[model samples]
Target chain A: MSGTFYGLGVGPGDPELITLKAWRIISHAPVIAYPAANGNESLARKIAAPFIPEDVTELAIPVPMRREREPAQEAYDEAAKLIARHLDDGKDVAFLCEGDPLFYGSFAYLLDRLAGKHPTVIVPGITSITACAAQIGRPLAARNDILKVLPGTLDAERLKQEITGADAVAIMKVGQHFEKIRGVLTELGLAERATIIEKATREDERITRLADVPAGERPYFSTILIYQGSEAW
Target chain B: MSGTFYGLGVGPGDPELITLKAWRIISHAPVIAYPAANGNESLARKIAAPFIPEDVTELAIPVPMRREREPAQEAYDEAAKLIARHLDDGKDVAFLCEGDPLFYGSFAYLLDRLAGKHPTVIVPGITSITACAAQIGRPLAARNDILKVLPGTLDAERLKQEITGADAVAIMKVGQHFEKIRGVLTELGLAERATIIEKATREDERITRLADVPAGERPYFSTILIYQGSEAW
Candidate 1:
């Protein structure tokens, strides 16, 4: 009598950006799991709070956003086993993903363990790239233009190459690596066209051009979108 | 007393996928516009139909989907002027885009004409890439994996080169270009890993592996996602 394990995408920073399917699941799922950062209230759970009931049992997987996820694999592994136990008890477990569960989400780590054994569904959410683009009133790419969505976690050399070949580029996870990514965009002569967004769709969201952004540490949830608008498509 | 112009992203196929912001705008906008194929009911309009009142003034922007849009620039220009007219008359116009209005969306064309003159806001929606990934329960990319979103409108040579350089690829508008993109994936030894999704999140949604898809005409809403999972990130 095991129940389905659902991975819900709550979307980027906005509570209302969650899809109807995700909202339905969040409201009804008896057992829910969300990744928390160093014992902090989970961002995914926060975005889904409007839909989640007070009675649902919650499991918080401690996933550090400031550090590499490989080091946190053991924590996720244990979380999966605990979640599987709940599934075995016939209680549908909704594991909230920050964005699209498959898009750089921590839920992928859990899906590897739970998806095969239990019924699983991944509800897609609005990505930071698009949300940032909307906030900036800039098109990501159009008319045969190729958009390369890269991670700022990449080495500077690889980041430079990826930017050079892209018509449009959106870099995610630009926490402390903003300076490195900014350098690549500069080398490729795209720094002026780049827009950095922090906590997109949130009330306190910030949008600034690369050239205007002050030198400092950015929040963990940020995206850098660079458009080569002059390129002939 | 000119009115505000908004670019609303209705989301990938699901009607309920529309965000609360978009829903709020769509319900109250004096005029709404959406890209239509010839004289048919617009797909964007259909996704947003739930919010649009029967008496709301509708503007159908005829944008050909079966052919390249370069040849249809005049149509978009005309549509933009018509929308601007509504805004000039103190009417808030909500132009519906299928996905994120700024993420490879047709709204960009209208924004170029409207945003400079009238107040504009772009509401982000769930991208087809993420929605397709959700439908398949696969993440688009994770960690440092670079996701290349290429248009099927590209030349075969360019498409092959792009695919080779990408850790993950999602090709948009795979209508008649399915075979061409399939060939490129086969050349890159990624045909087996490629998944084709038609009308993702729709009632009659179809999901098939690139290799297993029968030789036929794919829908204009189709997407082909190729993942290079063997690479060590």
Candidate 2:
């Protein structure tokens, strides 16, 4: 019988935010796989470190930081082949993801490659949207309100239209595109209602108003939440 | 000093899906509060049952089922007073919430009434959006793709507009509004791309394509995920 492959969501930065189901799977899995960007340590591994046994076999897939998709696609293709070997040998392999695996997580690459060929299971975890909302102590959406999750990489015009239409909005991946997103929100007269939470649930988490962030400063691993609901806080 | 208040998300439906942070706080809480719909057992309490100590004081707030806001507001007002009494006595109160508290959760009602008066912490959990996506083995959104979370209670015309604009969409609270949402998705030629995950992560969880569900049959505790991105599954 082929071994089962588990895609575990380690959650958004906080070690303790991982689900009990993920914890159990990570603790006992014979093989562990996670994405590492170039020379940087794997954030998913760091989050799941406490639960991972020291003797477990580690497979770190080196993901390149690039704009084009070919390099990353090749990396996932190679990693899938390596993970497939373990499953063929009847060894369960667990792939750790930073947030809920299917919520903008890189685990999708591997899932796409290995799902049909192997038995698979996915355990969801706390997403950054909820984690950032928790840090700000505000509801993202309530009652009949619509919540929009936009990538900051989107064009300014698209951002403005989405923000204008939604009651609550969470703009993510706000790296260099922070200025563009801020410009759009300001144009829509929503700058005051937006709050940026950087590295939420982490030890060095920072929360700042969109209007207060320094000019030209781009914070990665950050999410900006805008509340335009009836009970805007 | 008054005892701190905690809003813990216990995850969608599975008991084991609760995060380690939520479990820790729940296990050690002196007073645990949860919202119950009239005489219905508190879903949050049931989700966190394993961690809850037998002798822990439980405050079951009776949330009435009504469209009007006053009756529910009054219930929360009364519940807030009782929870405040526990906080005043330096008893740490952990309010259990289903999924993430701020994401269309009733815990927000209590948080609004009590946050300024007490030190509060919110532990995020696995949302139904991610859980449903995980169950169906698909990413909710990936790599700059916009994701919209809409309430099924929204008017059909408004739902059509929102669905048309996003690359990925998750329609929640699909009880009586299932037909309305299905109609919108079908009209947009997205019915084939949609999947309904009912009570994801639970033992009785069911995954049905939009085309397979019977006419006039509505499933509560369900989410409809529609993907229209370039890499749509």
Candidate 3:
């Protein structure tokens, strides 16, 4: 009989943020896998390091750093094959995800490849959006407010249109596109209301006003949360 | 010196989904508070019941069941005053919230009242959005796809406009407005693509297609996740 495949979300950043369910599964899994971009240390693995069994077999899926899709698709394909071999040998494999597995997480790509052939389970984790909101001590959305999560990679015109209709907005992947997103928010007269949080719940977390961040100074692992706070809950 | 106030997110329905951080705080808290409508058992408290120390002082914040704003506002106001008493007596109070405290949670009401007067720390938890996605084994959003979270209470015209722009959508609070929201999704030609998840990660969790649910039948504690698999992510 084949072993089940588990997609475990370790959480946004803080080690203690890992769910009890995820911890319980990670402790007993026979084999484990995690994604490492360009051979860098996997954030998900690091978050789960304290709970993982010392002698468990570890697999690191090396995802390319390129912006193109083909290379990353090939990596997930190759990793799926390796995971399948373990599953075929009747050893359960747990794949660690930094956040919720299917919420823009790399595990989704792996799940798409492996789920059809094997029994799979996904344990959700704390997303960076809520983590950032918690750190800022502000409500992400309350009452009937519509919350929109936009990618910073979107063009300025599109970003403006989305933000215009949203009662609250969270812009993810604010690496190189930080300035463009900030400019759109500024043009929409929301610069004062927006807050940028980098590496939320992590040791090096930084929370700053959008207006305070200097131009061309792109921060990594950042999300911009825009809420007017004018509505009563 | 006054004790610190904490807003702890206990995660979605499943008790095991509680984070180690939240569990840790709940275990050691001198006093615990949770919202309950008309003295009903608090879902947050139920999710956190396992970790709470038996001898710990429990506070039930009685929230009235009303559509009007005045009564609910008064309830929160009174609860905040009572909670302040514990803090003033140098006893730490932990407020339990289901899902992330800031994400459409009632804890936001308490946070606003107590944060300014006391030392407040928010411990983020797994939101139902991600939990529902994990249960359904589907991606919430990937690549640059925009994800919009609309309240089912929104008017049909507004829901249609918002859904039209979003690549992925999660319609929350689908308690009584299921039929109206379903009508909107049908009009948008997204009825086949949407999946409704009720009480995700709980013992009685239910997953049903939007098209399968009968007309005029409203399911409680539900969320509708709509995504088109046409994008290669």
- Mind giving the per-residue lDDT tens digits that candidate 2 earns over A1-233? 78999999999998999899999999899999998889799999999998999999999988777654333677777889999999999999999999888888778888888999999999987899999999999998887789999988888888887888688999998998999998998889888899999999999999999999999999999999998876722
How many Å off is the CA of B192 in candidate 2?
1.4
Ranking by lDDT: 2, 3, 1
What's the CA error at residue B195 for candidate 2, in Å?
A: 1.0
Q: State which candidate, 1 or 2, has the greater TM-score.
A: 2
Docking class of 3: medium
Tens digits of lDDT, candidate 1, B130-149: 98998998778887678999
Runs of candidate 2 with Cα error greater than 4 angstroms are A69-71, B68-71
Q: Tens digits of per-residue lDDT for model 3 on A49-122?
A: 99989999999988666644333677778989999999999999999988778877778778889999999999
Pairs with steric clashes in candidate 2? none
Count backbone overlaps in model 2: 0
lDDT of 1 by residue, A12-43 (tens): 88887887678888889999899988889988
Q: TM-score for the first chain of model 3?
A: 0.96
Could you give candidate 2's per-residue lDDT for residues B1-233 as a string of tens digits? 79999999999999999999999999899999998887899989988998999999999888776643333677788989999999999999999999889998888888998999999998988898998988899889887789999988889999998899688999998999999888988999999999999988888999999988999999999999998876732
- What's the lDDT for residue B125 in model 2? 80
List ranges where model 3 is wrong by over 4 Å.
A68-71, A229-233, B68-71, B229-233
Residues B27-139 of candidate 3: C-alpha lDDT, one tens digit per residue? 99999999888879899999999898999999998977665333477778899999999999999999999888999878888888889999999999889999999999999
Q: Which ten residues in a row have the lowest lDDT in candidate 2 chain B?
A: B64-73
